[model samples]
Target chain A: MKTKALLFASAFVAVAASLPAMAQQTATSPTLDAIKARGFLQCGANGNVAGFGLPNAQGVWAGLDVDVCRAVAAAIFGDATKVRYTALTAQQRFTALQSGEVDLLVRNTTWTLSRDTSLGLEFTGVNFYDGQGFMVKKSLNVKSAKELNGATICVQPGTTTELNLADYFRANNIRFTPVVIEREEENVAAYLAGRCDAYTTDISGLASVRASRTPVPADHVILPEVISKEPLGPSVRHGDARWGDIVRWVHYAMLEAEESGITSANVDSLMTSTNPNTQRVLGVTGGMGAMLGLDNKWAYNIIKQVGNYAESFERNITPLGIERGVNNLWTKGGLMYSPPIR
Target chain B: MANANAAAMDAAGGIGESKLMAWVRANLFSSWANTALTLVVFYVVAKAVFFFGSWGIFNAVWIGTSAECRAAKGVGACWALFPEKWRFILFATYPFDEQWRPALSSAIFIGLYFFSAMRANWNLRLPIAWIAGLGTISVLMWGGVLGLSFVPQERWGGLVLTLILSTFGLALAFPLAILLALGRRSHMPVIKSMCVVYIELIRGVPLISLLFMASVMFPLFLPEGVSIDKLLRAQIAIIMFAGAYLAEVVRGGLQALPKGQYEAADALGLSYWQATMMIVLPQALRLVIPPMVNTFIGLFKDTSLVLIIGLLDILNAAKVAVADPQWRGFGPEAYFGVSLIYFVFCFAMSKYSQRIEVELNRNKHR
Candidate 1:
């Protein structure tokens, strides 16, 4: 009886000891394994933000952030359509990612020190290099943000825009009243109703709001000055190093594809090119894709299915009247530079 | 001869008078004060009506881009965008080709509801029919067999999701509520306190907090590798919240019951379960039908709150539809469309409840 009791206790201990190990393995890349098992990527996005991650009348998701999701899907499954989008609001985005409701959050989220260090999240890379700008009625005849002294501006509360507006005004010794609104649509309505002299937000946001909310797009003009930097990027939950690497590399691949002049239309032909840089990017040589635990054709699939970064920007953002600005490649005097794939 | 002539005139006036004229006199011009008020009100209402009619229908752009809508902006409403974007509003991110499944499933659900609303259909077969109907909807929606393409639950949205959440939330909550009601009234102290605590705790908090907790905090508490579906978590929160309120409603019916009913069941030597089921519950439940239906209607509207947790119910889907760059300024049209849909469903449910109440009262009298 004593021996039997001891054996039972020992067996229980053994099982208990192994349980956490089993759990650790599953928890390490829980999102990645789940995506593979489900045969699709679950991406959190801003379904209402035009030129970032909005859906069209046909229910097709468009915009730059949406393209990131598609590109990641292509890299993983070799099919861009193998993605499901969860339309999340600003308040719900991080919690949705933390709870594993989505494999990735590719919304127009700004990367910051606090979010990177404390939120248990890792931002993959900045997809849109944005800055805060002002929009005023053309009747105001304000060509620059500096001219808006003593102006009442409409801004969304609890955003970097509010802080930037305050900083810019204080630094320039301009007195201004702020009509803080919570919703984007409400801000636009307040601005149009003359509640404020100007509407302040990220430049891309101002362009989108003006295009969509104004009866005549020409009635509103975005100011010439950009006050603060807002580098919007995709983010993933921490503790998944391999998944982080995969998301980061997918972004780099798009920029690299654009720099190498490899359009989706000509990616197949470029796969046969002898040039070492194009060959490395097209996965004709090098094991970079394999290092990320993907097939050699992963980068090729992303370029062929979702196009390069330049194509995505032009397709989604260009129509909003937003210029490439600093989002263009380094070769074109922009900040977009990717390390060699080799 | 004068009296006869006067009587004949009165008779002629009464017989030949227009019904419209009489109605106007009786309803609109009954008193001098009423007549003045009515005329003033009529003028104001008419002005508003004509303004809306001209803006919304007569001069509105019917089908065009934002530019066309803008050109006609000062003259009329920009209604052209609705026809172009109605599909996205109705179906949300649901795939275009597979939309028929959600559409057909929604129709089936409504048909089942109408069928159950008939007083004659209230029997054991009702539950059976409901189960069969729900099963069919599930098969159609989450298809992996019968040669249909598999659409995951994450892809479900818009009106279909709204109906599913409310209907499923109410159906699941109903039985749990009854159990809670009985437990609250139970002689066992432990069971009674547990029931009381659960009901009161859930009732004390708002549904949104519960939903937020379920979507965010609940996952953190679970062991690793165990994940719940986002829609399911929100649905569960709705059910729990509804169940608590429903329990109190059922308890109201239970308290109103005469003690003689229970005493009579005891005198007949029936078991506790048997006595409650056969003798007491039927009368109590019949009495509570009106309040029960009121609760159901509230639950139906409360389903829209799921939008906060990112489930695209009909309201959220409509918001998303007009959020496009091309249709940004057409929020009024989108909101009006969604409000109409919500009104039709809630109004039908209320009307059905009135009919059921009348029918139940008639049966009680009989």
Candidate 2:
């Protein structure tokens, strides 16, 4: 046994000698180059959360998050068809992004300080600004989150919601028992099956869950308490700030398109417009895309292919019954102001 | 004396082939085509082994993530992530000062496993010894007294947590399974039906569903103000699930018992319980000891599924550790390392089972 242990240790040491050289492999960002060569973007998404990211009965992936991946694929390649989706759990998301197993995370992940700074990730932009809320059965007669004191709550574990729930309860000095599951959809089912008294997550998620209810959502009520700020967004690794900036601005261009009234329907007409801002955005003006090694009509192609931010939201979120509340344009008394194109 | 006759049959001034070469010639190189195929098989296997050894041993990273790993360089492995997160990967979310409890518990569990596996120690007092030992380990691990602070099972994780789940699961299931298997073959219809219902119901459902039921529906069945930790609930679900399968294994041994043994015991005027306990069960249990060890290896691997219920066993712990921003892209190495640990355990037990099987057959022949 001693002889074997010595042999094993020596073998370990011999293997350990090469690790230092491997560790110095030079921090190069090869993701963009890989995507360019493959002519497609490999995007990771939530597998089966309705309206956020879900696979259809036919096994094709489809959702608002899935659409964001399509939009990125369209922006990179000329066609939105050049996209591959990798399904991921909440616990698996950051690791997937960090490992370069997926080019970017388009899952409905809540942007938080710990995840942003500590996880070596940067939130590109807020695609959906949401808030933590709860949904309970109507028979419970629970009208608000405050009334949920002493109630048993079903929650998805290993997420931003877990921390937010802890913080909310600790702050309010209200105690509630938690029944945790790793998968969100399972927790939703368990909640409805009377195993748990309430289900807690982001407000948009509640609406999506309600919309897909088998017996209709009227049996349940979403309480009016917005417990914590949830900025749902896409994130890329921090290895390449240049690539991060490009992804961030892709989202920024969509918000700017809505602000400047550049609808997908009239994007062609606006491309030929005389307005300095439109000219600058559409290629007749400043060389914005040229700075990033892309063409000046890059933003135009994005808008033409996928529409603006508000359009994406209105087409996806509005139909799921998520009102504009804080997601509306700045002129409509909301907070979606963007940096000017000029 | 037969040399002349053998030389005559050889016909070509030789007895066809030497003894050593004759065996190989017949078995491996019977024809020209067979010789070619054998050489090809040997060459391919050697080449495959050489390639794997070069990739896994020669070029792999063993420690420290450098700029190369950040850029994803090594052709073999990126083990710098394990170096950066060695602690968290070994003990998830556990407080720094109290990690010794889990470490100590793991040592105790390993020692117990070794002791219990020896046939010499397989006595009536061993179960009692196991209960006392495990009880002490749990208290020491979750100490709220004796100047050691309390740590909840939810906070307990990593390799030790996996060990605990498998150990406790076996402790709970094995004896219960034996009794159940016996009851299933009982003369009384009521007890037989009860055992059959239990085994069938548990065997029918998926383990994941049972885990879900434990995590969610279990608390509802209790009166108000009663609560159970999520970890304990998952443990109970695993034990019950294993018990049903183990009951079938024990029943196979019972069925293998000869009818003559039952008749001889009955002819001695012994009661049914006495016949079973004193005469049948011992020989039957000894017959099935080999398969029972295989069940243990299966249980050891199945413990990983507990991660779905939110307990941070080895797989989940390694996941949480690699997800640490400091050790970016460390999934391949950490996952591979943990998988090696699992392979070593299950492989060793399976091999031991094979050895004991041969020994048991040898003894039976004697």
Candidate 3:
């Protein structure tokens, strides 16, 4: 068994090593060709998650990740509404992308090495920098995770949050009991029923649960400590290098637009800006769109149609009561940084 | 008649008590232990009914918003969720103003089912009416012409989609199932083996795997520029799956028919097709109505599995509707409504099947 595993591991390494060389053989994207033929972009999205990607009561899709898909559509077709969304469960998302059912997956998927390398997928960039945190009742008078040494935590089984909870407590030399449930709603119900002292999940999920699931939002407080990094992003199929570049730059353009103070309202007027960065981003002076096989107004179209990263964040995530602590741009002491457009 | 019987009983002096009291004593108060058991059961059942009645109807918030429902949570059901989300649950992401299309289409489908269920309509007129009715439903749903806005199949969802999938699925599959059953019974070696292979191959796997393949894996096999509609793919998968299961039930029916019936048809110098169609099939099909309706109801409920493929069937639409931030944690109310919808359709099928069974078996009972 050990020898077979070693053989499989080495075979995987060989295949992984040859992927980049194979990717360089194609300068054009078959996915792009198909999208152009179909006259719309197919986006695999999350129908269940509230802020990241979900449909409203009218069946209209909205959210930060949804905006990413819209931005890509705007960049390509110069029309954000040209994208059609297919709501996918987590198990279906990767297979949907790999099988070419969707051009890209803009669901809230965490970027990990195994998924990146073994699954033949390319993580474009992180749109939401999330981390696991504990949410406890404010009446508990607990301000930090350190205080929950002997308390029971409610967590969903088969999630990274469960493993992280154990690692965090064991590393801190604190013993605690876990009330593990399979379904997330049941887990939250357990926490809300006082079956456990604390509920641990991603901070964004905690915020969503507290804001929407609980009776009173102010009664629950997310602890200060974030135990693990969860860089959620969009992904495309491996070896689709040109398509990967387009999806990647869509994220960066949104960030650059946020940093340059350009938004959907002001993008058309910012066409005559004097700054070189603004001119290049808005496609006034530089033919940057041609390099990615698009119209020169690609970035401008994205900004004009879908707005910048900040606008989307405020529009979607803000309603969920999530703060932009780590998702803010680099200028505000956050991790969201984009390379120069030129 | 009751008074005459009572006078006769009193004249006989068997018992002075009325019939109601006699029945009560015989059934409920026969002995001390039985009486005690009956009272204990009665108390528990009464308590349960009272509890549920209070929770589901009496104390439930019916004429208010989510806030009112939230306040009444854990104590009473939020029945108001139905009024608030019924449209969303029924129509899903279809255009709001155009929701009337699906509503009317669903009514038309139910009308067609009702018309087809009658014994008087079992003739060529039935098929003609069905075709006309189904054509009208398609036009109403798609609506490219007739001065109505065009809606694509992708936007089709909710109860309408569920009905379309199952109704068309079983309707198309029933004929195919009959053919496959006949083919399996064919005297030719190739035809028999082919039917056997097809049925076993499809029945070997669960319906979900086939749906997954159609939704997720089948696209890879298509050429780069070609793609089929996801709904069409899922519908085909469902029909194929139902065809295999229904074929087995039909084959069982064909096998159960007496050999003398087929021999009688042959003795009248009937050909193979005539013998099978006139003599064998009528008895065989009548014999298997119960099991065939069982498969039909099963297929109808199994349409909910399309939710996994991201199609907004009724169950998936309810899940999405309750996921709205304004109305979360009302899952029980939403699912109760969904279950009621499913139960109405399934129970109707079951009751209709029983009626047909008794109707056809009248001669046998005699």
Worst 10 residues of 3 chain B by lDDT: B218-227
* Candidate number that wins on DockQ, 1 or 3: 1
Angstrom error of the Cα, residue A41, model 1: value is 2.2
DockQ for all models, in order?
0.40, 0.02, 0.35
Tell me the tens digit of each residue's lDDT in model 3 across A1-342: 443343345335535655665556434566687789889999989988888787777767888899999999999999998888888877778867765678899899999999998777889999999999999999999999999989999998888888999999999999899999998879989999999999999999999888888989899999999999999999987755778899999999999999999999998788988989999998887788887878899999999989999999999999888989989898999999999999
Candidate 3 docking category? acceptable
Kindly report which residue pairs in candidate 2 clash with one another.
A23-B66, A23-B67, A24-B68, A25-B68, A26-B67, A26-B68
DockQ metric, candidate 1: 0.40
Worst 10 residues of 2 chain B by lDDT: B321-330
Best by DockQ: 1
* Superposed Cα deviation of residue B82, candidate 1 (Å): 3.4
- Candidates by lDDT, descending order: 3, 1, 2
Share of reference contacts kept by candidate 1: 0.64
Query: Which stretches in model 1 have alpha-carbon errors above 4 Å?
Result: A1-34, B1-40, B363-366
Off by over 4 Å in 3: A1-28, B1-17, B146-149
Provide the TM-score of chain A alone for each candidate, in the order shown: 0.87, 0.81, 0.91
lDDT, candidate 1, at A128: 94
Best-to-worst DockQ order: 1, 3, 2
Write the residue-wise lDDT of candidate 3 on B143-214 in tens digits: 988998987776788999999999999999999999999999999999999999999999999999999999
Provide TM-scores for the models: 0.90, 0.52, 0.90
